[model samples]
Target: MNLNLRHAIMQNISGNSQEELRETIVDAIQNGEEKMLPGLGVLFEVIWQNCSEQDRQEMVQVLESSVRK
Candidate 1:
């Protein structure tokens, strides 16, 4: 079966408020399921696209720090 996963995930959460989105992210991370990774990636992609360069750099720094532990 063909699936546009990103599109489907985005569509599913399109109307979510900020709090709802935060809860979704928290739940996904807490669950730690492989299936949730793609959804988190899409969320990160949206955040990356919308953020400023400085914000992106900060995120990169955080990512780097996270992986070093």
Candidate 2:
């Protein structure tokens, strides 16, 4: 059986409202379960794919700065 996690995650969240999306992220973070990491990565992939180059750079910088803490 083929388990396509990224596609499945996208399907689960498709058509969600902005607030609903925010809640999903917030809930996932608060829970801090390892199983939730793939879904979060897929969401971040979608964001990276849609954003401009400058936005991508900014996100990278933000990630770098946060991880240094």
Candidate 3:
């Protein structure tokens, strides 16, 4: 079976509202399932593509801090 996971996930959530997106993220994280990681990575790719340099820097900082604790 061939599947383009990123494209499929994007298509599934294409027109979601902010609250719906938030809920999806929260649910994925709370579920803590390995299968959810790819979806989150695709979401992060979208965010990284759209964010400013400062925003990226802040995200890196937060990621670093989260890993350190």
Order of models, best TM-score first: 3, 1, 2
TM-score per candidate, chains pooled: 0.92, 0.91, 0.93
How do the residues 1-69 of candidate 1 rate in per-residue lDDT, one tens digit apiece?
Answer: 125988899999999999999999999999999989999999999999999999999999999999999
lDDT per residue as tens, model 3, 1-69: 125988899998999999999999999999999999989999999999999999999999999999999
> Which residue segments of model 3 deviate by more than 4 Å?
1-3
- Model 2: runs farther than 4 Å from truth? 1-3
Candidate 2, residues 1-69: lDDT per residue as tens digits? Answer: 124987799889999999999999999999999989888888998999999999999999999999999
Q: Please give the range of 10 consecutive residues that has the lowest summed lDDT in model 3.
A: 1-10
User: Number of clashes in every candidate structure?
Assistant: 0, 0, 0
Which residue pairs overlap in candidate 1's backbone?
A: none
